[model samples]
Target: MSEIRRFAAEARGGTPENDNRRVKDSVKRLQATVVEFNYLRSDGGRVWESSPLLSTCRIDERSGSLQYNFPSGLRERLVEQALYSMISLRVQWEFDSKYGLVLYETLKRYADRDAAQPWWSVKTSELRDLLGCRDKLTDWKDFRRRALDPALEEIDRLAEFCVLVIETRQGRGRGGGQVVAVTFQIERKPKEVAAATIRELEKPKVQRRGERKAKAEDIASTVDARKALHFLTGADAGTRLKWVKRAEAMGIELPKTASVVENLARWVPQIAAALVAEERIR
Candidate 1:
């Protein structure tokens, strides 16, 4: 390969000088860029896992020009056993929402066929961490509306997946349970790059037994359950006990022998409403 002209992505504070004749604007470069990568072992062996391609990178001005340097070993890996892919610069420039960016990369994890699964489950708490909204967007509904839904909409519109769906884990005896995890599905992949990705994905997954599970607090209960249960019966011990039996009779199953709040928070308020209606009619 031969060298070509290099220039800054944007001009460095190229506006009129201020009253003090000192440029008030600061010139800063983006901290990161997205890259898709493939990995191979020393003997040209396939590594069946998608790896994190983003690394510490910086732009330096030397010899009156800009230079890009990624962390050590990154260049060697790319040269020896890796290939990289990048999306359009305009696409990167136009993305405004942090949620959209978080999800866009998450979906990239499963963007290919054979190599990457079409759908994958990640813990919701892990997703919160990935989105950098940890501790801030704690409420599920608010997180979904303010960050997740908008991200989905924007990514579905602009990104390669075209459509991405997120659903809570529901199966076995776990239906209507707290959303401890999220499953992601992609409707379509980018035609331009997907062929290469699918070819890479044809490699088998490198098996490593017993990966550590994500650390999340046990989903002991829901907020609705607490208020509804309190409303169903007053603070009296006998009343709450009788109502628990009544709730069970209504097919509102609760986690057996869990904390009182845990049991109360598992089901909806329909059972309580039923008791209220019966009392009113009498």
Candidate 2:
């Protein structure tokens, strides 16, 4: 239960009881969900199959543990194929909507392609199905306004890759042209920026906000100063020097290694608390 809450970014800030309720709701939804798969075999034969997402689910409130199993048929094929997407839970949890999350995953599938310009085009209907908004946002205008636009905004802001809307209209009619499809050009961020983004995501929510506040106040001269000491301990010499410089700039005298080691028990927790509150307002 604790692990589930930690990985589920949305649930991390909630109370234990609320988090448990949310987990129960998610488990129930998964148990009730049905999935369909269509496959083409090497001999040109086709197979269509359907099954519940989970065959069985059990939860023990007293033990605060949950157990579930996938449908047997799907489990066998999954084990045999071993095909899956490796998505970052941290990034996925940052998305504000399901559309953004789904679209991010869809684009991630093509992130490894060697093409100079990687893109994906999907029919409006097909996209609606992928986003699970087929029935709700039936109208193109409503769907684009409420779902597509917000999703694109979130993806561009939070994802490691940004999406460019290459095309959307096809036929000439009302509103300039009828919306028929969406084509997205996937552009990966620079290596350094992407690495920094990953590091930001890995931080605790409060610490991240604190760092942002510190930056906003211009209190820290170097970005490396905001990094926790533990992270710098394993970093290269240049990185460690930047942290030391940051401390010096803050009017703090550096203690020798022997003195620091002797006072570790007294100062470690205080250092952690200071880091958390350094950028706090009032």
Candidate 3:
């Protein structure tokens, strides 16, 4: 029973009789939350298990797009449903720390790359933009009321614990219950605070310039000189060798040039041949 029925019963002119049904209905709102959760667990499980290469699921706010970043192929299976879920959720509230991590982990399993990176580490400015509205709900009750309509049609807002329920003449079967109740919480972070907090969510770290230089050198060492020659030749073979020693050290097998004019004369054919071979030019 809702507090409304209890209040009406105690009042002098109150008609508690009709309140009986209203109270019963209100309680079911809480129950729907549980039902939605089960549905999500079941359906979400299927998506994850079936589509391993699909990762990086996001609910876009501006255009209300549910973008999925998958390795390949897997997205085609779920893209339509993913879009449906995104539309259903209405995404009234932004994802927070706990909920964000859950989504990140869930989607990461389907991603091609390492899913171990924390949600905060994903560096998606677009997501942050979506989350910008977190602190904007001034009227919680009004907001909840408006949100309830879509929740039933769309998604499971675990953080809010809300569901849209529809009453039925018989039992609440499929297509019987309209969206009715929900369990959702609203965050009231101030604009300044939310902005500051989100910024710290992805702070850039500084490293020594020398360290960066060394890392670059290390990366350079792994270059395949023969492969580079192949590419250069295909590109036109006329490209000048800026660093003769470095090219030679890279095993490019190119002659060191003391004179630019002489180097260009010889370099063009070498580059053109490499290009031809790359293209399998007979």
- TM-score of each candidate? 0.44, 0.56, 0.18
Candidate 1 regions exceeding 4 Å error are 1-63, 73-85, 114-117, 169-175, 189-282
Clashes of 1: 1
The 10-residue segment with the lowest total lDDT in model 3: 118-127
Backbone collision count in every prediction?
1, 0, 21
Q: Write the per-residue lDDT of candidate 2 for residues 119-161, one digit (tens) a residue.
A: 9888888789888897898988799899998899767757788
TM-score winner? 2
lDDT of 1 at 182: 79
lDDT of candidate 2 at residue 99, scale 0 to 100: 91
- The Cα error of candidate 3 at residue 85, in Å, is 9.0
Q: Tens-digit lDDT track for model 1 on 116-214? A: 448767788878877878989798789989998878865654565655556675545444656788778766756865564444334332211111111
Q: lDDT at 236 for candidate 2?
A: 62
Q: Model 3: per-residue lDDT, tens digit, 217-246?
A: 656433333444444444432343443443
Show model 2 residue runs off by greater than 4 Å.
Answer: 1-29, 38-48, 57-67, 80-83, 174-176, 199-282
